[model samples]
Target: MVCIRCKMVLKDELTKLGLHYTVVELGEVEVVENISVQQHDQLKAGLLKWGLELMDDKKSVLIQKIKNVIVELVHYSEEPLTINFSEFLSSKLNHDYTYLSNLFSEVQGITIEKFIITHKIERVKELLVYNELNLTQIAALLHYSSVAHLSTQFKKTTGLTPSHFKQLKEKRRSMLDDV
Candidate 1:
């Protein structure tokens, strides 16, 4: 549930159930009102039908929140981030960057920074597929130091230079929902 469609489903379900949500993110949703045990079970069952789960454990919930922050930063926001990914994530989640990194790596089997890079690269691929933004613009928008850096990292991650990736007709870009 890292994509817009997933968020929409969660939001729509909450509305249908007359439950107001403060947030609907990957692996978790925060409802505004307290619900009965039966209602909670019903909501969880309903979400399961969409292949979504209601996250419990505090650590898991925090992890999902962190992932949601990154996803929101990369895929949803129109404005560029003012800080680096580590600082931004730590600040947003109110946790030390080191602790967050350790927790994320331990649970997800990948570092938080690597997860961000993967999402950023996926965003770049989407922009490339659209052929709308030039490399320079894309690099700037994604906060890469330079187009060269973006190209270098992009090539390293996908095994193809951005230019080559742009020219290919097939779908090289991945779906964010798959994340």
Candidate 2:
């Protein structure tokens, strides 16, 4: 799960299946009772119907957790991170940065840094479309070193300058999940 609606769907499905859940945070859930095989199958089917999957493996779960952390940080959190991203991610997931980086690259076919850049650019596009924050403010909010850095990245990623992208009639932006 990556969004609130996904959590709601999971909660609804669990209730319908007569399961009690203690927690349903993004990418993780904790049920009160041990689920029977039938309940597990029903829950999996229900989630699948809504385009979600039940990840039973450790590696897949960890990957989802990493994604959830990035999504929450980029799209939801307003506070800036105190430490460097590698340190922060390593501490948050309680694994060495090298391990996480390797596993993420091996499984996702992209480096973690690339994943972060993609999401940051997506967020920048979102801010530009909103038209509330100027380029400098957007850069600051997204932790860019300067507006020039943000512009360079935005141009490199989208093949259009931020101002040009903003002025376009279509105002194209990708979904968070797609990013």
Candidate 3:
């Protein structure tokens, strides 16, 4: 789960399955009762119907947690981080940065830094399409060193300058899950 709607769908499915959940945050859920095998299968099938998967493995759950943290930080949080992203991610996930990076790379076939860059660029594109924040403000909000850096990254990732991309008739932006 990566968005509110996903959470809603999960909650609805749990309710329909007669399960009581204490919490249903992004990428995690805590049920009040121990799930039976039948309930588990039903829940999995329900989630799959909505294009969601119930991850049972430790590695897949960890990867989803990493993604949820990044998605929350990039798309939802308004406050800036006091520490750098690597340290922050390590601390948040309670694992060494090297281990997290290696596992993420080995499983996802991309480095964690690359994942962050891709998400950041996608956020920048969303902000540009909104047309509310200027380039400088967008850069500051996204924690870029400067507008020049943001512009360079935007252009490099999309093969189009921010201004050019914004001025086009079709404003192309990717879905957060797809990013």
Would you list the C-alpha lDDT of every candidate in the order shown? 0.84, 0.92, 0.90
Mind giving the per-residue lDDT tens digits that candidate 3 earns over 32-79?
999999999999999999999999999999999999899899998879
TM-score order, best first, reads 2, 3, 1
The predictions' CA RMSDs to the true structure, in order, are 5.4, 4.9, 5.0
Rank the candidate models, highest lDDT first. 2, 3, 1
Report the lDDT of model 2 for residue 70.
95
TM-score computed on alpha carbons, candidate 3: 0.92
* Per-candidate clashes, comma-separated: 0, 0, 0
- Residue pairs with backbone overlap in model 2: none
Compared with the true structure, what per-residue lDDT tens digits does model 2 show for residues 10-86? 99999999999999999999999999999999999999999999999999999999998998999998899989989
lDDT of 1 at 102: 94
Give me the overall lDDT of model 2: 0.92
Best candidate, lDDT: 2
* Segments in model 1 whose C-alpha atoms lie over 4 Å from true places: 1-4, 15-28, 170-179
Error of 2 at 39 (Å): 1.0
